[model samples]
Target: MPQINEKTWIIIAVVIALIGSLIYNIISAKKLKKKRQQFTRSIQSSYTHMKTIEDTNKKIYEISNEINELIREQKDTKGYIEKKKKEIEQIRQMIVTNDTILDCTISDKRDLATEKQIAFTYNIPTGLPEIQMEDVDKIRLFANLLDNAIEAAESVPAQDINGKNKRYIHISILNRGSNFFVTIENSKRTEISVTENQFHTTKLDAENHGRGVRIIRQIVAKYDGTVEFTDKGDTFEVAVML
Candidate 1:
């Protein structure tokens, strides 16, 4: 106790250094494990946030599509209203005059066979040549064409069982060389039957309906026009040349 040997002191110092090293290693290992756990938590949090953002973006995209569809529907409604108004005004003018009047307003409701709306589009060429035809005749022809187109389109199924797109109708009129050409196209579920004999309709109920095509043919014939009917796949096309 009075005088410690140098070798013993040295051995004691080595033992102390070994103990300190072990303690330091243990502390460092604990700290390293804690850091690893923190890093893992941070990574999981980031992944969660990313997934949340992705879901949010998908919802936003769906909402945007819905908004766009709403806007399109509104526009179509507006257009239909305006067209009806114009037709009503024309009918009123005809009543005021002493000319023979024809009720040319076609119904816009959905047909019984199909749940889709009866859509119609009309086109009148600009810069029409001066002709001898009366305004009433023009209106009658256009009205009949549109009516027939609507009927044809309504005959087809709007949405299939798989929820596909609805049927539609398209009408175009072009005046060339003192003649007017009208084309009407409609989406069809099955192939349309075209005949040169008596006119036939695919409409199931024969009591109240099924005469639209015959009436259109008569109207076209009254104007000394030629009417041609054709079928292509699931589409029916009617052309009138006057």
Candidate 2:
């Protein structure tokens, strides 16, 4: 074989160096691409996790609102229960003695009377009349009527300096001709109006509040009683006969 020349040897060395550099560049590029792919996947995963957290937060907010509404309703129910207990005690005493006077008065909140307010008076007969109704029925009738009156009164401005409208409630119970009659009257704000056979609410959102009248009507119907309402445009009156 012919001896290699120095110039040829130098050329061979240069070629080897170029091939090594090319191989190194290809390997580096592949490693960089792999790292970039991994980084993109990590970013996508973080985004997905963040979206999940946001969705969960939204659901929690909705649930909290519903819970708050339910709590308010429960508080109102508890207040009604307390009132009923006191009224029941009075009724029981009257039942035993065959005669008694029942009176109740509730104040409004903020002196605005734009909340549940109640006042009622009932005079039992000196002697139990024949065909006397059950104590439960009587209690139901009185409680429902009083509750409705309170709800109506709560809707109006307690003191209207501008005479916008004054809230008023008057409830009286009478026993006549073997039947019991109750009358409730209240003043309403001019802008608010309630129609018969439909629920009227003072709440900002009707869907959230206003079932007192509906429940009262149901109770009255159960006793073969009649409920009638008179809408005076600025005032309302309800009567029940049992």
Candidate 3:
């Protein structure tokens, strides 16, 4: 056999190096893509988790307000006091219970709203079923709805009744064939001032605050439901279909 020439050997070495470099590039590309995907998923999960926490804190704050009010109403009868005491405990149980929060839970939240002088009404069907969500999620969901409704309604004053402003919130649940609906409407004293129909939070620490409607959207996504908002000049309405 003829001895291989140095030129041929160099060419062979160069070709082998080129092949190895190509393989390395392909492997590195795959690793980089996998890492990118993992990072993206991590970011999404963290965002979802942070949003959930923020909303829960809001619910807790709401419950705290109710508790504070009960503690302040010291001029009521003993029977009334006992009744509120049980109500306080019941609301507290909702905070930690694993069972889903239902219309009755909504009624409790409405009571809190009424304490704020915001008239709230909810009409749930006699045969209505529990929403398909966890207890915490259900609370968060209604908390966001009722909370936002209260804020908007508080901003707007109802018919200057006796020279005083009134606030009102109306909520109703409906069963539409294969889906459930929650319709909430609040009185707005002024025209809707949102640009491009965007919802903005007035939270001072906005970086840590979660968007209420966005959080609702996330929860609604799990139910494969849809959320719709209609700002009707003097009324802001939200319809959640699940």
Candidate 4:
């Protein structure tokens, strides 16, 4: 303030301008960083929302399939009441004729295969004690396997390319030293689809299907057993050891 020179005034002006510019740059950088952070949070929130929507859609799809199955079952109850009555009587008769629950289940499924024109043959060990399993498990395991086999065999043509009838299911049971080996083989028209070493159902009603194999696997796993699926082009075989 004591009579500054012109050159000193210009230098002071330049310094003030430099300081102002530096402060402006610092503020701009902070604002830009805040905006970038906000953008990142927005992207993360969008991704989370998208994933939530996807999961919700998956659950809705599962619920829809279950609803559809329940509706079909209700319709079936109305349409097949008479057939179910006949089947009940047949089941009673088969229960009277067969020795064990397993035998009855196999016989019932075999009769169904016969009606479908799919031959069923089973060679169960004679004089062997009933399979060491709970009655319900035995029925579930054998019934599910035979049901799937019969369904697949039914899809096979009445006569194969060789002009011979090969639509059949063959089941063999062996009493190993400490285990039971059961094998079910059936005719197939096309190659089976396998995913992650598991057989995928080829049935048109996919949602209502697929549960059978999963049930069978659960039963096998309950007994610490192993189930193997082998596809032989013209035939598919499922072998279980318990």
Distance from true location, Cα of 134 in model 1, Å? 3.4
Ten contiguous residues with the weakest lDDT in model 3? 92-101
**Model 3 alpha-carbon drift over 4 Å, by segment:** 1-100, 158-165, 191-197, 200-210
Candidate 1 global TM-score: 0.44
Better of 1 and 2 by lDDT: 1
RMSD of 4: 22.0
Q: What's the TM-score of every candidate structure?
A: 0.44, 0.43, 0.52, 0.56
Kindly report which residue pairs in candidate 2 clash with one another: none
Candidate 1 lDDT by residue in tens digits, 22-72: 999999999989767755654564455456446656755765675587687
Clashes of each: 0, 0, 0, 0
TM-score of 3: 0.52
For residue 193, what is the lDDT in candidate 4?
Answer: 54
* Tens-digit lDDT track of model 4 for 2-76: 999999999999999999999999999999897677556545644554564466567557656755886877754
Model 2 residue runs over 4 Å out of place are 1-137, 162-165, 205-210
lDDT leaderboard ranking: 4, 3, 1, 2
Winning candidate number (lDDT): 4
**Candidate that would win on TM-score:** 4
Give per-residue lDDT, candidate 4, residue 116.
Answer: 92
| Model 1, residue 81: C-alpha shift (Å) | 23
Q: Which is the better candidate, 2 or 4, if ranked by lDDT? A: 4
Computed on alpha carbons, the lDDT of every model, listed in order, comes to: 0.57, 0.56, 0.68, 0.74
What is the Cα-based TM-score of model 4?
Answer: 0.56
Model 3 lDDT at residue 40: 62
